[model samples]
Target: MKKLTLVSLLALFMAGCAKNTTDSPTMVGADRDEHGCIPSAGYQWCANTNRCERPWELAEVEGFDNTPQLFEAFCTGQ
Candidate 1:
């Protein structure tokens, strides 16, 4: 009886430790949705600012901007 109980407890502990990928929420930018950010043709997504920015641009609490810009130094056009 003791051995059986220990084995059951161990099994339960192992099961709890197992990862539940299906039940876990998917992170932002993982899917193609407005809530997520997608970089433009010449820009990259900045997770820190949650915006699409140029490689040289510094992220500063900015959000996603899909607008097109002309003569812009940064890839803000995206």
Candidate 2:
């Protein structure tokens, strides 16, 4: 009985860690690339000049010289 209870608890924890596709919003605008998702703290895509920009592309536009820094900025919005 103890073993069964432990197994069930582990299963529940794993299930909770799984991603919920239904909870994620559909990707929109030109920013979408092969990744199928945009970078943002609140899942918000970057919009400039009334158009959505991909995170990588936006980083270049914002004058980030290094790819790592650009990626960090894109994800953190700093």
Q: What's the true lDDT of residue 30 in model 1?
A: 48
lDDT of 1 by residue, 1-78 (tens): 999999999999999999777964466444433534444334555444456555433423234243333213234343
- Segments in model 1 whose C-alpha atoms lie over 4 Å from true places: 23-32, 35-78
The models' CA-based lDDT, in order, is 0.51, 0.56
Candidate 2 TM-score to native: 0.30
TM-score of each: 0.33, 0.30
Displacement of residue 68 (Cα, Å) in model 2 is: 47
lDDT of 1: 0.51
Model 1's TM-score against the true structure: 0.33
lDDT of 2: 0.56
Lowest lDDT block of 10, candidate 1: 64-73
Q: Model 2 segments beyond 4 Å from truth?
A: 23-78
